[model samples]
Target: MSSDEIALSPSSLAETLRAGERVRVLDVRNRDESDQWPLGGGDVETTHLPYMKFVQAQAKDEIGDLAAEFDDGERVVVICGRGESSATVAEALREHGLDAVNLEDGMRGWARAYHAEELDADADGATVIQYQRPASGCLAYLVVSGDEAAVIDPLRTFADRYVEDARDRAAELRYALDTHVHADHVSGVREVADRSDAVRVVPEGATDRGLAFDAELVGDSDELTVGDATLEAMHVPGHTTEMTAYRVGKVLIDGDLLFSESVARPDLERGDDGAEEMARQLHRTLHERVLALPDETVVAPGHYGDDADPEEDGTYTATLGELRDRLDALSMEEDAFVDYALSAMPPRPNNFEEIIETNLGRGSVDDDEAFELELGPNNCAATAD
Candidate 1:
């Protein structure tokens, strides 16, 4: 078969999953790797079988018999750490008359797969584009107005996507902004600035954490203009000491401060020894800063949990009023809120320490290394009970 006929792009698989089509996935990675970060989507069935098993079966001339276990008349999408091993297995399955295709570039490609949707909210004559990374539930935004654009919390893997997206809209990428020093993934702010004429902006609080990059440092209530639109910085430190949210008209580009179903884990910035105090700070920020916004203000968070459901428009956003009513942590007293924020947190994101260092400009990594470092679910939020 031709290469195109035997290969599936990650974007194509994402589309199929989003459309609720039934898909059978054959995961050829080891048990630990498969269990730690399983593929996720709607109406999908996944079977985990290490590639070594296929190797052993092929050696005994039982490849056909082995393929029989997965030849249930449906196309199987095979995946591995990278696409190399899976391609061999997929070709073997095809030789046995089963419809099998390799997931191009494997799980790493899936992690790089991104989707952009125009948000259904008022951006004061500006367009708000929500970039969703389904693999990690990381969310970023692009605000465009009058030939000028700014990106908030972009991932390094897709820095070019943001610039290309801005150019396609007839807008110049004016600003690359980071809400905080991220711990889950490498920040694309520096890369975006290097690729375009955009100015790099980071929170002033980040300087305390040894921010080694050259950029404009914004403080509380600072405003930046993107053509006719205004991005007003609101320093709402909690998840991290530098956590900031940008308000573009009625849409709030809130960082890890809040999410659709859960709140940010405060311990990422400060270890457990200082987590309680950070949690207390988080509670105050929620009530005095976030909840203070108008009920109609659309809250666009930095990350979404697996349980988060997108709105009818396919954007992971909610109004301040809706989140206020839904999140129990948002309504609790200070003491209770702090306790809730710290209890039952999921494991910190994989390679988070190194990721944070790289994001802070204290360390450097090549593009491939950066992509590999963040190839897992972004556990940036506290587990909701």
Candidate 2:
């Protein structure tokens, strides 16, 4: 088969997985890399066989034997770090009479496999599109009303996707907003602004974190209009001192302040020295600012955990009342909440410091470098009971 015919694009794989078609994946990346962030999807089974094993088997004239191990009736999709080695392995397996296909661009491509789900909730006459990055479980949003659109918490890797999506809907992209200076991935606020005539907006509290970019700073209770819809900025600092949430109709474009399965980790910005204080602030934000909304307010967080099941409509969202009842930390006292927020924290995101510098406009990386930097799980959430 031709190389093109022997390869499956990440989007195709995503569609297959989303459709719940049974798929078998042969991951050929190193053990550590595979263990750190493995491919995941509904009804997809994965088997890990390091790429070096295939190379050694081929060198020993045992490629046939190696391929025989994966000779099940199902077609296997081979994946590697960048897809090149996996393509070769897939071709070798095909020569051995096995149906094998390489995952185009491999895990990096998988990281870029972004899916957009239309939120089935009221947005004050606006259409809400939730952009889900499965590889990292990062979520961004696009809100369109009348003729204007705004994108929140966009990733630099898919900046153009947001612009194209907005234009496809016959709407002018008016605003590119970020909840705060992101530590997990490079922010696309600048890229979106550069691509369109959109104004860049960041929380005014971010200025305290040495924000050097030129953006319209929004303070507490600040409002911006998209067509006929109003986006009111709520300064709800917790994950970081600059974290903010935007309320549009009944939906809140809440950044790392909350998630479906966990709350935001408070140490990313200030580390251990200030984690306690930040945790307390986060508690206040949850009780006073976030949970203060009506029970039916749709809380759309910026990220979702691996175990977080999406709603029937495929959006990772929960009502304020639901989260208040579901998360134990939300119901805890101030001291208990702080202890829960700081206990059993996961490792910080890969290359977070550098990503933060890039997002802050204090450093720069080429497009390829930026993509490579944020390739792992976004360990942005704290452990929640």
Using all chains and alpha carbons, the TM-scores for the candidates as numbered come to: 0.94, 0.95
Q: How well does candidate 1 score on lDDT at residue 348?
A: 90
Identify the candidate with maximal lDDT. Answer: 2
lDDT of each: 0.91, 0.91
- Residue pairs in candidate 1 whose N, alpha carbon or C atoms collide under 3 angstroms: none
Q: Model 1 — which ten-residue stretch has the worst lDDT?
A: 36-45
Q: How many clashes (backbone atoms < 3 Å, residues ≥3 apart in a chain or on different chains) does model 2 have?
A: 0
Q: What is the overall TM-score of model 2 with all chains considered together? A: 0.95
The per-residue C-alpha lDDT of model 2 at residue 66 equals 78
On TM-score, the candidate that comes out on top is 2
Residue pairs with clashing backbones, model 2? none
lDDT assessment of candidate 1: 0.91
lDDT of 2 by residue, 124-218 (tens): 98999999998888999999999899999999999999999999999989999999999999999999999999999999988888888899999
lDDT of 1 by residue, 154-216 (tens): 999999999999999999999999999999988999999999999999999988999987999
